[model samples]
Target: MNIFAAIADPVRRSLLEQLAREGPTRVVDLTRGRGISRPAVSRHLRVLGDAGLVRAIDHGRERHFELVTDALAEVSNWTATLTAKSASAPQPPVAGHHLDALGLEVRRTVRERGTQPGTRHTAASSTATGEIA
Candidate 1:
């Protein structure tokens, strides 16, 4: 399953949070007061392991699980990519100096909206201003 899908489960996510906070922990230690059986925790761990969110180490008889930092980085990177794309939408630049003017207008609109300037621009405003070069 994908990282998102694996993390969609409250139990699995909780397990991950606990691992992150507590460091490499045993399955038995993870199950304490969770209102779930050891087998159930084991199952969730298995799913997390499959998704590469957790790494399991066999220490003699007991297995210890720890959070895989890189897996969380993937989620962070994916969100950052989407934010970058949406914040600067790929509309083709208007021809010539009009592009600069349009950029200024975009900044103005963003400032008016109380958001970071130039994050968004409107076609109607440019058209009305006869600046659609």
Candidate 2:
């Protein structure tokens, strides 16, 4: 099972959280007060074990399960790379910002050329005035 798929279930995630919080724990302790049967929790734990997200150790007659955080490095790296790319990505222009910038540029160009509103230098006027150059 894929690590992501193993942790996708709410029950499995809860079990991992419990293991991480309480360190190594027994199956009976894990099922206590959770309203889930020991067999069901064991099945979930088996999935987690297959995904390398958790490990089980036997001490005498009891089995202890503990979280294996190293298994999540792939997920962590993937998310971190996505976050970095998004942080460096160019943001989309805000509404009306492009128009506002265009308006300012037009105003600046008109001011520089000393052109008046509703008046423009046409090809005919430039040719007649010999100002084509």
Candidate with the greatest TM-score versus the true structure? 2
Per-residue error for 12 in candidate 1, Å, reads 0.6
Which digits, one per residue and each the tens of the lDDT, describe model 1 over residues 1-133?
7999999999998999999999999999999989999999999999999999999998999899999988888899999999999989976656768978988887777777555653444677666666573
Let me know the TM-score candidate 2 reaches against the reference structure: 0.69
TM-score (all chains, Cα) for each model: 0.63, 0.69
Candidate 2 Cα lDDT to native:
0.92
Q: Give the best candidate by lDDT.
A: 2
User: lDDT for model 1, on a 0 to 1 scale?
Assistant: 0.88
